[model samples]
Every structure is written in structure tokens, then in C-alpha cells.
Target: MSEQTFEATRAFIATASAEQVELIAAALRSRRLALRPAPADTTATSTSSLMKIARLGDSVQIARIQPQYLSGLTGTVINTRVTRVDIELDAKSTRKLARAKQTRFEVPAGATSFVIHGVHLNSLDIL
Candidate 1:
């Protein structure tokens, strides 16, 4: 078995006491954490858009990169312009989506396959 990202996240969050969790939840309020749905074999809805957007709701299953796509995407997309669409795990809870950050890609209208990394994801929706 491998170290599940969500499990790791939950463990990390568990370090905080119940009071802290309540405080954190209170602070967050209704902010929906961002998430990346796992990629599927489905086809893209549109083929010629500047960016194909997607949204992943809460609780989905995902696997970390299997060492092949890790090199290209081992960090956050704080810099550089992304050119491919990707599913990511960016939730504010720091456990469900691992700090709830948004990951984006620059969808190229010319390719049929793309890979992204640093994706701690569970579910996703296509835009």
C-alpha cells in the first residue's frame, strides 16, 4: 500500500486539537475548497477554447503520479503560464484538498492527451 494523500492530510490535520479544528472551521465559514477531479477516459466537451475549466466536488478517489509525470509537475503553479488542463487537489482544509489551492492549466486545442502533477485530487467536473 502507498501513502494516501488524503490520509496524510487527515493525519496532519488531526494534530490540531478539536478546539483548533472548530476555530478553523469557524474561520473558514462557507468557503468551498477547490479540488481536482480524477481524470477520466471521457472526451473533452469543447475542442477549441482558450481554457477548459473543471470543478471537482468533495470526496473522490485519486492516485498520485506513478513516477512518470512527476518531473514536470512537482510543485504548485505559482509562476509560469500553464498550457494544459489538469485536475488538482486544492482544498483549503489542508487535508481534503491540501490547503485548498487552485491548480490550472493552459488547454491546448491541438492535443488529445495531457498529464499534470502535484495533484492531490478526488473528484472533478468539466467546464
Candidate 2:
């Protein structure tokens, strides 16, 4: 994506309604897909092997875009998609701050899993 588009997306996400964000997250999660950058050779075989490497239950470090959220948070991969990843969040820190009533970006209550979109792939780093 172009820099302009990327920034626009970030802005949109930042102001997106809770319902809208949840809807997008739900759709992405349902796919159970993961994305890998295409190889240098366009005709090369797909990166099924690489995807498998970050399989379910694998530990991963996901970069955070919103300060209200945690950055470099370690979580277990619960699902993957060609353009997104689903992770079961580690709440060791969040649990303590759950009482905060600040109106900021946050994981939904009772939601253990969250989806990271392909556009934000750079924000995800597999450990």
C-alpha cells in the first residue's frame, strides 16, 4: 500500500466505530488466514511452508499501533489468514489495567482473540 493509503487507514482505524471495527475483525478472523510477502519470483511457489512455521500455538510478538494498547505484546497464534492473523492475547499486563475507564482503543471485553490485518503486517513480527 502507498504511504498515503496506509496513513489514511490508520486514521480510519483510529476513529472507526466500535461496531465497525468489531465487524471487520470478525470477518477477518472467520477466514483463519495468514499473509506472507510474496517471494522475489512472482511465479515461485506459495509460502505455505513459512505460514506453517508460525502455526497455531506458536509464540509471536505483535506490534501495537495504538498507545492505549500494548506494544511488542507476546501472544500465541490462534489462527492465520493470507491477509491477517488471529492471536489469543496475553493479559498479564492488561488485566491489571482493566479497571481504567479511559476512552481509548482497547480489546473488547471477554475477547481473548483479535485480528491483525495485512496492511498492518509490518506491525506483526513472528518470534
Question: What TM-score would each prediction reach against the true structure?
Answer: 0.18, 0.39
Q: List the residue pairs that clash in candidate 2.
A: 32-80, 33-80, 33-81, 34-80, 34-81, 34-82
lDDT of 2 by residue, 1-127 (tens): 9999999988998998754575456545533443545667688665533222344566777665555354656667666544455666566534523445555536577654544333233456777
lDDT of 1 by residue, 41-99 (tens): 74765432122222222222233434332322321222111222233322321232322
Candidate 1, which ten residues in sequence have the lowest lDDT sum? 75-84
lDDT of each structure? 0.34, 0.56
Least lDDT summed over 10 consecutive residues: which range in candidate 2? 46-55
Cand. 1 TM to true fold: 0.18
